[model samples]
Target: MFKKEITAGAKSKVKSSVQRGIRTKVVETYPLLAPHIDEIIPKKSQLDLLKLPDRVSLYALNNEPLFWQHMDDAIVPHLRVVHQFPHCFSRIGIDRGAIRFVLSGAALMVPGLTSAGGQLPEPEGQLKEGDVAVIMAEGKEEACMVGQLKMGTEDMKEKKKGVAIDGGHCLGDGLWKMSID
Candidate 1:
């Protein structure tokens, strides 16, 4: 949603109850996040909520963005969060050639993910549509973007064309450029 560089909004401390709720929701949506829940959203740590354009809500810890949600859509982790705990999220990789496009904030295409250099979850359909995914580039150690799947991995393997993910938060996007602190 953050297609352009946007300025920071006021940061407010989230209530303890709300923090607990967010923690619960995150863990529920991403069960793999359970093990690191305490570290990601420590019970004692205060969380900051920042309002961004297009009805997005960003949750940060000590000025480091942990997660963001659009309207009432499923909450997705920030790229920083994905980098901090890479294995905790479902990830797909694009070929080296697609790295620049992804970094520039273009929506992911199936070919970029189905190519020889790309990597998708094994057995296909392991990751379904509407699920949030981390986009890693070939040979890269960290993810370059995070976005919800427009089509299931199974569908992508079948169609081998069309968009894979839309509205992804990428490495150099406005969200990444925004200085939370």
Candidate 2:
């Protein structure tokens, strides 16, 4: 949704109760992050809440951004944040050809993911639709996007051609470029 660069409009310290709620939500959404919760968000450290345009809320520790949620949707980790815990989420690799489109903020199509260079979720993994996944592009060391699946792995294989993932935070996109301080 954030196609253009955005600046944090106002900043405020998050209350303990609200911070607890956020922590709960984060753990629920990303169970792998449970063990490192303290490292990511220390109990004694102050968490800053930045209010951005279009009702997007960014949660940051000190000057480092951790995650952001659009409206009341699921929280999406910042690309930089995701880079710190690469194995925490399911991943889908896009072919090099589709890298440009993803960076341009386009919804990822099925072909971009099912092509030879692309890698789909393992069949045994049983990824369901709406599951959050990190988008990695061929030759890239870090994830390029963080989004939700539009279709299940089986359906993506059967259909072969259609939008595969909903747009969320992408490399070089507004969210990725947003400054917290």
After superposition, candidate 1 runs with Cα above 4 Å error: none
Enumerate clash totals for all models, in the order shown. Answer: 0, 0
| Pairs of colliding residues, candidate 1 | none
Give the candidate number with the greatest TM-score. Answer: 1
Best by lDDT: 1
Q: Give a tens-digit lDDT track for model 2, residues 1-181.
A: 6779888888999998999999989899999988888889888888999998889889999889898887887888888879998888778888999999989998888898888999887788856788888999998889999977878877887789998887678889887787667
State the lDDT of candidate 1 residue by residue for 1-181, as single tens digits. 6789987788899999999999999999999999999999988999999999888999999988889998998899998889889998998989999999888878889999999999998874378889999999999898998999999998888999999988879998999989977
Off by over 4 Å in 2: none
Structural RMSD, model 2: 1.4
lDDT value for candidate 1?
0.90
Candidate 2 lDDT for residue 27: 90
